[model samples]
Target: MTRTLVVVGHGMTGHRLAERLRALDTSGAWRIVVLAEEAHPAYDRIRLSSYLTGGSRQDLALAGRDFTEDPRVDLRLGCAVVSGDRAERTVRTADGEQLPYDALVLATGSEPFVPPVPGRDLANCFVYRTFDDLDAIRGAARRGRPCVVVGGGLLGLEAAHALRLLGMRPHVVESASHLMPTQLDAGAARVLHRSATGLGLRLHCGTAVASIEAGPDGAVRAVVLGDATVLESDLVVFAAGIRPRDELAAALGLERGERGGVLVDENCRTADEHIWAVGECAAVQGRCYGLVAPGYGMAETVAGRLAGRSPRPFDGTDTSTSLKLLGVHVATFGIIHPRGGPAAEAVFAEGTTRYAKVFLEPESGRLLGGILAGETGSRTALGPFVGHRPPADLEQLLLP
Candidate 1:
């Protein structure tokens, strides 16, 4: 009398779905099967760069050590679902195994976006996505060699740091006018730029890659900028961006987003009631969140519904980010930019030591958004104060 549930893509979000379902489904009404493309089970992709710093594979694992001990759960690593039949309620694997499911959930996550440039497929070039990719980069990296990293966002900075750890000269190339264009404003980026350069890392802002020039051996020799500036390099890494892996859902005629992602409702359900989507692959309310926190929230919502509990709709998520880049603290939360005209802004800076800015309502003194660079001791208290009015004596609390 038990129903079968097939969960596709065993990334962090899919693993979360399985773990939560088994925990809440006490009646054992549904048995779960997890299909993963990678040979390894779920590991934290957010901390992937930590692998370069002596962090082992097991250290990045998200699931428990005894994850597969449960009798109701089946974990199939390196098994990819090739096709799905909605009418038959079945899925076909790459090795010709057919799986029947009363319900199906897609957690395919995403893939890195490599820009179209000549010589991109050269031998010394790579993308920072998986454990294997890091292994390849480390194996190929020569000490004292010059390395070029495209993009200057979170992942790009992490890659540059990793290269520096490997004893390579790292140069970060950003097409945007400033670093972390989507996350930090000009002032915060300037502080980050200074900090990065202080670490012996070079910065090339507002410069787009025109092409990668390969030597006679077909390995990377140098990178040509859009403005015809050529910099010699032995390695190139593209940390441009990521796009959702919604092809499987798209094949089944499921609705998708304008850019790319499997469109889902508030409950993370697709057009077919039995089919659901979560993680970076899912477009909740017509937008896909690339962060693990939001994906974890969606997993909780889906697990509840499958357990016959009250459905909690995934309304939206905050784009808050808090992390250390090259040993420097960086955190940004809630509406870094204002929407309704100009708002009252406060600025605090002391040379290159630290910089902090807070935006408040001109009339009501309500906190709208803020950016903190160089020092973030106040982030622990200030992050929660977003969208609310702070106390009158808030200046003392934010002082470095």
Candidate 2:
């Protein structure tokens, strides 16, 4: 008997789920089809900034030409899921074709969130999310126009650095008191602030764009702030935040979370038996994990279970993360701030052009999680210690 596996959204989780399902179900001859909304093949979105700076286009692809050109898997590019019929077990594409599936998986991913503000519809405004977005940025940068990145978080900082690389003065506007507020402690944010400012990218902490007004012909000329001041700029990019893509899932009558994610069990199964969801689109136990690692874990678990292989339940995700921002390496795992009294303590080390900090629980002194900025050669060896339930004493790794 032949089984048809249709994966909507050919991003990281969708491609992974399809490949793993086929590998696990060796007995079932299966046909796989992947529909991607973007015209490009699955690429490394995490490194999009690198491409924005100077990285080659060919380097961004996670999957080579072989995968897209392969005959076994039908890769449908530039296709969007307009609708889905759960009762009929079929998905309608933007085109006239309605594809039938014995089993379905949705991994539509997310979109960059730009809040409603005055003059937002003006020209020279953009969001940093897709390859097309980066290409537009590249075109703007070649003309050496001053760039303003609205939002001082990870992606925003990266965009600022990329703009600086293109020989344009880049400014960052963060509504928070410091940069990387959600990821780094106050002190760590200060260190990053100094580092970024020293590199010539202006930092406006504790403030944001009140409005974006156009000049003579509807081209962005200045970013107006609430403080009654305007920052001169010709280009603006928004890396503010992202919201999960679950509009299609919601129309299917499947249970969804308040944050607009399809509610799924540990095994990534929705209300229907033959249906599953994974990646950023899934809300497991009323929570949506925006990270890639947890999304891949969900894909692995669901694929295993569908193939009649027993797998461990999908536990709630950890908030641990490690990444580089504007050439600064940072990593954190466990809880940086513990709940009880004196449970969390921060230990830090300083070197030439580098900073590292670890937060540990008092009694356990285990690695609750920490951040490394500037260089991360050591965190590769240090991650296992934090990965192992914070260890017995958090002070040991920092001191010895």
Per-candidate TM equals 0.94, 0.90
Top candidate when judged by lDDT against the true structure: 1
lDDT of each: 0.87, 0.78
Model 1 clashing residue pairs (backbone): none
Candidate 1 has an lDDT of 0.87
Cα deviation of 35, candidate 2, in Å: 0.9
1-400 per-residue lDDT for model 1 (tens digits): 8999999998999999999999899999999999999999899988998897679999999877567777898889999988889999999999999899999999999999899999899998999999999999998898999989998988899999999988999989999998988778787888888889999999999998899999989899999998898989999999988899999875677889887899999999999999999999999978898778789889999999999998678756456678778666777666565766888988877666567788888898888777777874467788777778977666665654
**Top TM-score hit:** 1
lDDT of 1 at 348: 72
Q: Return the TM-score for candidate 1, rounded to 2 decimals.
A: 0.94
Model 2: colliding residue pairs = 329-374, 333-369, 365-393, 365-394, 366-394
Instruction: Summing lDDT over every window of 10 consecutive residues in candidate 2, give the lowest-scoring window.
Output: 391-400
